[model samples]
Target chain A: MIPLILYDIPSKLDGTYWSDNITKSRFVLGYKGLPFQVEWVELPDIAPRMKEIGARPNKLADGEEMYTLPVLSDPNTGALVTDSWEIAEYLEKTYPEKPIFSNKSKGLIYAFGNAVISLILPAAKFPIFRASQILNERSAEYYITTRQVMFKVKISEFSPEGPTRDEHWAIIERAFNTYKEWYDEEVGKWLMGDVISYADIFIGSILSWLKRVLHDNEWEKIVNWHDGKWGKLLADVEKECKKV
Target chain B: MIPLILYDIPSKLDGTYWSDNITKSRFVLGYKGLPFQVEWVELPDIAPRMKEIGARPNKLADGEEMYTLPVLSDPNTGALVTDSWEIAEYLEKTYPEKPIFSNKSKGLIYAFGNAVISLILPAAKFPIFRASQILNERSAEYYITTRQVMFKVKISEFSPEGPTRDEHWAIIERAFNTYKEWYDEEVGKWLMGDVISYADIFIGSILSWLKRVLHDNEWEKIVNWHDGKWGKLLADVEKECKKV
Candidate 1:
């Protein structure tokens, strides 16, 4: 049995999907048929252990940087893997019997799907959220240092000019729309085929987050898939995430 | 030999020293000591082929909504791997003899290095670039449409804000600074060890980019590494990139 440290927030019951990767990881654990132990470390308490393990937070700490959450560790191999994509790859490689990536074609689709969740959507949107939260603070140093990445957003007219709440959701909406268009043309239902790949798990988890933030019109198309099998699993994980 | 098409902008290379996954592919081809033919497709020209492959670009027609560059296809395997990290995985699995992801420890580090390049740094920097770029335009539709996954700056930022003349060289400074601190503490020299991993290749290629955007200060660091073995290879690449 591998010891998987979930280092999480205690708010899943509140229905907050704090990290998209955590939400996705839960679904992967369930779908992959692996019964593993999850150690819940509250985010506040994660500092020392994170440093000891060379893991950082995904969000900034008190003037410190953040690393991604939901790291998978095989105590047996002493392999501590962070980053959702890396974890997915690790699990796929380690658990070839059950098979996550399974085949090359499937793996490519999974990689593409992972890129959508891991790269494109977040790069385009997270800064808007950070900028909105720190807007009125006089100490731009705190703002800039704390979120050095969002500096690019400061130059955008929308940063100082437009209302940011609308900007954040707008980015999310655009991403979803782009995904919908791609989904329609490609494998449509699942990101790859009828069978669920790691991509489905990754995308479905984010879909949960979007649903939480989106208005009815924005979420209408995305919610349909939730009614299916994987959707139910994601809903359950959302329950776990809210507990954090 | 499987015919492979690499959609790349020979002029615009990315990632840091450790990101030599693409170069590693080329290196492996060289190491296999076999002559292999590779086709280069410029960034601007990939639109039609992208659409044909069912990927949608955000602003670029026929491009993926995400920054989908360095796509590799094994005509023999009919396997098209996107994302440099994925390409490394695909190649290692397909060519097990001279495995790129040599071992579990190496794989863990390689994956970590890839994430640093692909997610963490970009997440920090891209939003600022996006907000600034669209600041004047400031249309809700425009903001929303482009927000899905913003294209990462192929260059770097040294100025207070926005892309500057020294922007490309700035990328190298920021990228090297990131690893320098890590090198001082945990592992010395290259990301994993003396022998290069994907991280080394990623860093190497990006260094190649910085070398092209040469400044006296920039070339000071470049000259140190260039005086070595890789420096020679990098000089060769610099010439090729300039030729384009």
Candidate 2:
């Protein structure tokens, strides 16, 4: 009878959501019409709090623990799922009806989900830098500090501005262009033809993140590419999942 | 109805097959229970011959026309499908029976098929060199000559024996290992769980090519990796498509 709780880290500015994965999980919840409450855990508290709630850390290659956002705790299933893709799997498993992943293509969807992430990460430096800007003061501090150490450069140094930022933007545009070629013909307004599936959700989620982060002019530049493909898809997502 | 004609490049040794793509197309034909005849086109003649048959060339980035194999001409529909993924789409659209692609996952399957090829291409130097060794005399000569000119190295120089070949093999093994990590559990033998789809066919075709080209010891080494995952999948493919 109780609603599910989605654990996410909130931004400082009016506690708005920012992470692509969190936005995706929210879309799933909204799409499924699942009653869910957002339980905002600040970045610093996420690790200790998540572990306290028996949710495990995402292990790095070198055995380091990585506590991440968008951990969905389904009170109905008495399970806490971590990682964006894993959260998708958990939701699909728990809520069989209103399924995002088609049974026939669940495995392929998983691969494509990973593929989408890979495509996004190549030009992610800008967004990665911008991400810290939206976080709460302490979380932003934690983010800038950790990421600076991680990249051996200040967050500002990553994206810089002007030509360098433009190069990163071009990479993203090119990546999406490569994806645009995947369409044999633009018959339907979706990846799986007329049907709206997880494939759309995956890319749309990232698009949503970019839309939220990028300045209006930058977002305007993107929405124009491929005859406004990204613009149209985001519109469809918003129309389909109003709660998201 | 007259049988469909699959245009392919045959290896020299008594007209044996060696191409990954042609083999994949063969798998599709057999799996669909469609009657098809192989029309062996020599390597040098493929572009001109295909152009004569009203089949188009796959253009390179430089806009040069490059004709490739596994072009399927269906006498029934009067369709000449070029490229492996395009062939898959054509077959699915035309036959619409005994479907290898689940309509729900067709888009994702295409993406996964492309992913499989990308994973295979990095360590393809050995296979690229070995490919010439199997071709007919004129074709082998043409292949070595063209490819040597392309790479600015003799065919023998590309995949020279010793540690270099070993390193190339390791890349392939590591690629497959990366794929192995994609699976969350060892539940089913197939990529899309119990059901075999185009994703399996794509990778299986590459495995078949490797098996045909690699020495028994080298092939055995691959078959043993990932707990005989590649070996078993190829077996399943062969069993499913006897003609292939």
Candidate 1 residues lying further than 4 Å off, grouped into runs, are A1-5, A12-18, A49-68, A73-80, A105-163, A213-244, B1-165, B169-244
Instruction: Give per-residue lDDT, candidate 1, residue B207.
Output: 51
Candidate 1 per-residue lDDT over residues A1-244, each given as its tens digit = 7545544433333443345666666666666656656655544445566777776455442365665467766675677777676677676667665454533333233324534654345434443343333333432334344344545544334333246546655555555554554444323345434445655566666656555434456456445542443345456444433322
Scored by lDDT, the top model is 2
Clash pairs, candidate 2, are none
Interface RMSD per candidate: 12.8, 3.4
Candidate 2 residue lDDT tens string, B205-244: 8888988887789889999987887898789888877754
iRMSD computed for candidate 1? 12.8
What is residue B169's positional error in candidate 2, in angstroms?
3.5
Identify the leading candidate in terms of DockQ. 2
lDDT of 1 by residue, B140-223 (tens): 234334443454333234233445534543554455444443433223344433433444455556554434334446456646
CA lDDT of every candidate: 0.48, 0.79
Model 2 vs. true fold: TM: 0.90
